[model samples]
Target: MEYLILAIIGLASGIVGALVGLGGGVILVPATLFIGINLGMIDGITPQTVVGLSVVMMIFIGLASTLSYMKSKTIDYRSSLIFFAGSIPGTLLGAYVNKGLDLPSFNLYFGILLIILSTLLLVRKYLKPVEWFVKHGKKRSFTDATGETFVFGYPVWFALVLTFGVGFASGLFGIGGGSIIVPAMILLFLFPPHVAVGTSMFMVLLSAVVNSITHISLGNVPWLYTIPVIPAAYMGAKIGAALNQKMKSETLVFALRIILLLLGVRSIIDGIWG
Candidate 1:
């Protein structure tokens, strides 16, 4: 019965995650923690353990989203590779750091960061955007699987630094790196929203895989908790991917921004009172 409940939770999370390029952390982390506490089966589940299980569910969810994004020819592999160069190492380091963190402190800090990021995203949309740095990078173009080419000029060096920071937070929180990556890609690197979403999913896949290994080394994950949710997460990812293509980019970003704000507040409140 516990496993059945986990599956249902995972299913809902997977769909929302894939849709917003969040890899399900916003829905999964809080839901799992609160519900697990309510149920005796997960009576003593630590934040690290909750994060580890979230990683398991996200891996499959990211994979499903990746495949769907690939079919639609929106993934920007070149950018992904550059970001991964930094993200991989960062995730490894973050996982180790996360093992020692207290839940309340982590929640407080992470929530603050999320809220800040969400504010920045919101501010950039309606206000005059300030140029962070001057980049004279050369424009580049790449063709995707469906013979569609995307051309853009981006600050590669800046992206690397940012990706590492995002990866660290992702590993620490088991968010699969998409929460930061998607917004960064769109708001920072100037990628089209759809491309950002697609490429972010791929980055999430890599970050989650690396992060999961670190969690495993610390014994944060239990196979039984992970197994039941895998299939449900996968199914949800497929549906999310389909929805992503149909939704307008502006609409998608707007929804994600709102979700992030809510997640941030929830974490802060939980940290303070729960």
Candidate 2:
């Protein structure tokens, strides 16, 4: 059954998503696309419809992941508030912008964007941008429930600017922006890897909420299908968070890179060949 297949995909998506910041919806879209096309169930599935359902799924997936990460005390609350400040307005703006876009153009640009992001992640070690971050004299730090302490510093202003774009991308593309944001936090802001994942998950919750509201208003969502996917993703998030606590930092980063790289390649293929 389609529902059974979606549930399985949703579970897998949640595990990888919470661990790396993909937010589960990323996995669902392609899977649904593939299945629907093959089964003739996707004839009514437009970009808007896919984005709407994805945002809805993202809302629950992110909330579930955030709760799990918070259990570990890995989420950065103060910074998360600032992230919400920027992401909220940006998500709304993205929906407005998305309304005028065509599917081919959207796929083409989105694909190109993914490839560029992948390249940035791959060459991050060799690239250094202008150091424009405002510093806290006292380092910002937090200890997770596991007693793992993470300390790091980033400019509040820089984060605000970055989150705005991240939110916009999430709305436009139906991703949680963790794929991009977590890498930016780790490589650019010097965040501890696990902390970055936790913080990104927190941000994902807020952005998905805002984006979901916008998409729902637009009537793009297929609630009937979305309902079955939620519980599996929720359970997967908990499992992923547990795995996150045990994985080595190097291994996490490697996995994230591979995910981003694969997303890039897939997006390009969709744009060029689909």
Candidate 3:
């Protein structure tokens, strides 16, 4: 029954992940907490164990979604590499920090980040760029200039900084890091939303792998549980990607924001009251 519940959750998470370029960790964490509490795994050390296991499972989820994106040629390898360069080191540092932090503190900080990310997603529409400015303070005056400015996207330095922050956050929270990266790439990097989703999956894949290794080294992962969750997640990712092609961009963004907001609120409640 535990395995069955996890499988269902993995499928749902995979669909969300593939469609929005998230690792589904925001959903997974809370779901796992609910399940763990029900199963009486809420005792000392078990909640952390569930979190560690969930992170390990997300590594597989990211890989599966990345493969689907790669097959569709949606991944931007150059941008992914730049993001990975910073995220890899940050993930390692985050893993070490996770080892030292208490569970409540971890949950509280993680919840706060999610809330901030959710709010950002909710307000993205209103924050759309009205003008494009170059590093030299020159603003694009023409519509064509605006389009061209965003065509290839933001400068490489900006991408690097964004990636590093996402990676660090991923490590700190034991998540796939796509929640922050996908939105950041689309909103700040000026990449097409779909392309950002695909590219973010690739970055999540790499970061998850690094984080998984750290988790394993620390004996924090449960391989038995991860095995079933991973494959289901991959299959669900493919299905979600297909659906993404048929959805309106605005609708998808709105749905993602609502989901994030709910998850953020849930995490906060669980951290404080559970």
Judging by lDDT against the true structure, name the best candidate: 1
The collision pairs in model 3 are none
Runs in model 2 deviating more than 4 A are: 38-43, 128-138, 142-150
lDDT string for model 3 (26-92, tens) is: 6666676666663554333344565576577677777777777777677888778888887887777
lDDT of 2 by residue, 1-274 (tens): 6677767877887888888777865677655655665355545666677778778877777888888887777788777778778777778888777788666656666667667777776787687742444154225776655567766667777778988998888788777777768878777766778888888888888888888889999888888777667888788887888899899876888887777677667766766677
For model 1, name the residue pairs that clash: none
Model 1 agreement with the true structure over 1-274: per-residue lDDT tens digits = 7788789888988898999888887678777776775345555577898888988788899899999999998888887788878898788888888888887876777778779878878886775432442244546665643466655556677777888898888888888888888877666556667888888888888778888888888899878878778899999999999999889778988888898898899788777876
The C-alpha lDDT values of all candidates are 0.80, 0.75, 0.71
> Where is model 3 more than 4 Å wrong at Cα?
38-47, 128-152
Positional deviation of residue 84's Cα in model 2 after best superposition, in angstroms: 1.3
Superposing all C-alpha atoms, what RMSD in Å does each candidate have to the true structure? Answer: 2.8, 2.6, 4.0
Compare candidates 1 and 3 on lDDT and give the better one: 1
